[model samples]
Target: MKRLSLAILGAAALSAGSAIAVQATAIEVTVVNDTAVLETRMPRALSDYGFFTDAAGQIPSANVTPYRLNTPLYTDSASKLRFAYVPKGKQAVADGEGLLKFPVGSALIKTFAYGEGEDRRLIETRVLLHRADGWLALPYKWNDEQTEAKLALVGARLDVDTPEHGTISYRVPNKNQCKQCHSIDDTVVPIGPKARNLSSDWMAAMVKAGHVDAMPQGTGALPVWEHRQEADLNDTARAYLDVNCAHCHQPQGKASNSGLDLRWEQDDPTSVGIRKRPVAAGRGSGGLNFSIVPGDSSRSIMVHRMGSDNPGVAMPELGKTTVDKDGVDVITRWIDAMPEKTF
Candidate 1:
């Protein structure tokens, strides 16, 4: 198997007017040729280089900051922690509608793990690097000992047992699969870190610290997905679906041919999948008549896809190998509570 070690230069290479350098030493990264090599236990793994800090240790890294999204994708029952960092001389520019145009060489790291304390098992670490050539997605599978992670280019599947949910099959997506959801206009982009997702205090601090250029005036904040207990069921369910499905279901996305728009910003109810018929779902529709039925989830093709893990029938063609029971239940409840409407 081929191996590569990159001495990632620090932000000092950029213009001098930029912010303070985030790091002094070159960040070393190990690249493997194939998944089979990573399957074998290898010494001096990716984690040994210290590009990412252990959240459990609570040690502060110069450039890393915990980031939150208004709504996030559901990956079975695993918990996720996300952080992002930019090069020394670069600051992310705030674009319209909460999107931030990150400078080249920025990186976003997300870790997936199950349980807490001694029982905690690190599953994987996904890194999105904004290289000069464009964004690259790398998936690293954590060792059973939690000491390190190895690059898995072809991806891997593992059966894990959870406390709340029994045995579940988890899938780690490959580099190409990452592009399935991250690609927009044929270019890979960051899904999270939108200005609307950041807390008011956090956004203000980011602007004050010069980490970001500035927030658009009169921008409204979006509620965290897990903290929407007080929101109405419809709003909560819409938010969940928007994050999980809108990435591809929107008009500008890969699934635009489906004619369904799941974005939270979409105000038209019919466009939001309410009584909207499928355009090209084919066998995936399960012979259902409408995308959503006001008071009947069993008749809703959207819910059916969410409940299925079959490749031919699933709404999302990649990333997940198992159904999100909690997410399905939420959608089911939301549908059941909807008032019956007449055409």
Candidate 2:
């Protein structure tokens, strides 16, 4: 009887272990092409790869972390992943695809993963061209198949030997950092359709704008969300803010602070700070008055809320753990972008 009990216990343990191994998780990568002039030129975009599962829509009982890459370039002598730089304004039109114009003088290289997830994939990079002519931001684009995407900019360097050793040194941003800001959205929906976990409003707009021919709609399976290089700030940055702050600052949100709102397109300086007094009466009422002190972010209560450790003072109250360094940098840059004079 004792022997029989031991066998049963071992069986139970194995079953539990198998179940734990199948838990699902998100996978992402953010490569910083240091070669790019401005960080802004590196398109800050996230594309959702479909759920990886076996027979069911569940993660396989295998190690997934091995798939992570820390370099901007991938190579496989066995596969054909070539690295090349194409000038911008020059259109590379393939038979079935649309004209993909490299942003004048920018270049890129392609390589394949030798070990895992092997396929001839692109590792395109570009630099933000800030010249007397025009300041060009980062360019990025996504294809329907998440597997196929490209990053293009105004001036980029490829096939150059750098101390980093590889074609590009990749820096993968923390996932929770992104989740922190995105979690703040009212509906918790991503801005773009391909990246969105729910709904397709923006996708419809893209179709309307002639950015794409049709909206991606299918229930068969989650399609690969291709990344679009060279996306406008209106679509990418604004969408990011919407998912990150709109929930607490919108008219319906909990923060009715001094009538200031941070919803998408609500960039009015006067509307961003204290009109009469602080929202919670005396809390952080620095006597300096105004909610967002016009141009000086240091004097603004809104900016203060971002770095505050106080439970009562932190903006987007519940997502502190997820707010990583990258998210903080992006927010700071955005605040800095605000005009000096109240508009």
Candidate 3:
């Protein structure tokens, strides 16, 4: 393994109290290039790596304090566990809009696993490393013995079964596929770590720990979507769409030409695609007339795309190979409950 060292100095200027010359030594700190080494092979156990504080030796790394998104990407039946760690002396900052800006040397790890207990299968662990230049997305495929995972650039396709979704052709996206969703404005950024998607408790903790400067106040404090049974159908569905589709459907996203913005903050019904027709949808529209149809999910193109697993017509063009029935159901119910017209 090779190591690279980086030293950064604070730029705050020192001022003398009187009319006298002042001299000071610039603070210098070195950071070990852990991302370089971890990119090669996945550790036999999550604890083998120092990315998290684990005491129970859990497969998902117990002390990592798993975080959830209001809306999450659907990847068949594989459950995902995500963890993020910032380098010592560094912290993630928030953009003007409250989006988290992870510092260079930060790493976000997500593991996709299937089944449970002895029959459990660790599919792959994807890592997003923030370097001085930019972010790098790397995927590591787990071995059959469940001992280790190795870097896999080309990706893989496997026939796997999930108790809920049954057997399906699962595809592990290649490096290029990762950039397709992660890149916004031509720069790779995290899609799920936005303040709106985080729980309030988690956000407060991050602020108190100095991981982020501050969260937006008042209306800016977005609530995390709760389980369907506990939350309003409309809110749950909107949150789902925000996480799963808004990344590409927003005004500045790759699919912006479609005229649909699924972001949570968009309040205008027309802009959010309610009763709005698709733009240049072609076959992707499934012959539907509108993106959403008020009270009819059956007549909504968005619902059609969400329910379809066909490569040519799915809402998301990548990362998923099967229909997310629960997600579709939630959205459908929301549409079903909408009034035919809103003045």
Candidate 4:
């Protein structure tokens, strides 16, 4: 990405006995943005779209703005730096507690990194482009030198040492897998940027900037993940499940056949995986009876599958190779906190 910055200055003079001159800074730096490149073509390099100011994809252009979700999806605990860009003169429409309906030519950029401070390394950057046809997802792998990132159309796997799971083979999902996670009723859609999950501060800023049409009804409806311990138990656990598992577990998702709906709005206890027997007899479980047994997590099949790393048995089956102890702990506590119904 070639970003050029030019400083322009001007001087104004006023008529007086002795003419006085005042200098003013006209403009700072003009951002290089080619909206046409974003709408068409699948270039070999991520920089071809001209989204970032630098080759590392750290500095965004003027049109791009960074954003974060209150509760994010956990993908092997990768530190996801999210950003969004909309074509000038176009604003995203706020859906009812759902995803912001971004217009065509909008782009969602996410860079997945690992490690802390100086040791940090960006493994990949995923882009979701809103084309005239539909949303398309692409993965670009970063180089060892931490420079430019190239599109990995087929995806890649590399062994890396992680803070949580030690040295494990990390899978950068292929284009088809991206379609799988984003698929909603056979149409690819974004899972993040939901109105309820956005922070109030971000909502206000986006509104003020005119990027978003207006503040949605339920901004910050989900508890912040960092301060989740201080929030309501049920709400926090459900939020985690919504971000992490609900994409596939909901009725319109790929895992609809399983009959467990973990969406935050789902109120029914049975639908939310309590006292509900497996739709499929075994369901790749260890002969567990219910998805969640009130006041007992060990017997709950949800917890059982979540805590496992087995290929055919893990709950999510994608995004995570090892277990999320904190997530599992929260769900476990939530289940344990439930009072068993007395017959």
- Against the reference, the lDDT scores of all candidates come to 0.70, 0.35, 0.69, 0.81
The residue-by-residue lDDT of candidate 4 on 165-277, one tens digit each, is: 88888888888888788889978889999999999999899889889999998988999999988999989999999999988899999899999999999999899989988
Lowest summed lDDT across 10 adjacent residues in model 2 is found at 64-73
Query: Which tens-of-lDDT digit does each residue in 1-343 have in candidate 1?
Result: 2122222232342333332332223222222122322222322354532445333332224465667666678777677778776555579898766567778757777888889867888788887777666777778888776767888777798888776667878889987788778877667777777666566677677777777788754343555666666667777788787778887888877787888988878878789888998888888889899999989999999999999989889867777767887788889999988889742
The CA-based lDDT of model 1 is what? 0.70
| lDDT-best of 1 and 3 | 1
**lDDT score for residue 322 of model 2:** 21
Displacement of residue 15 (Cα, Å) in model 1 is: 41
* Number of the top-ranking candidate, with lDDT as the measure: 4
Clashes in predicted model 3: 0
Q: Tell how far residue 332 is off in model 1, in angstroms.
A: 2.6
TM-score of each: 0.80, 0.35, 0.80, 0.89
Q: Which of the two candidates, 2 or 4, achieves a greater lDDT against the reference?
A: 4
Q: Which pairs clash in model 4? A: none
TM-score of 3: 0.80
Q: 198-314 in candidate 2: lDDT tens per residue?
A: 224533443454433444443111212122123332344344444456555566555544466655456664554423246573565445565555346566665566555465665
Q: Candidate 3 — which pairs collide?
A: none
- Top candidate, metric TM-score: 4
List residue ranges in candidate 1 displaced over 4 A: 1-45, 53-60, 216-220
User: Which of the predicted structures, 2 or 3, would earn the higher TM-score when compared with the native?
Assistant: 3
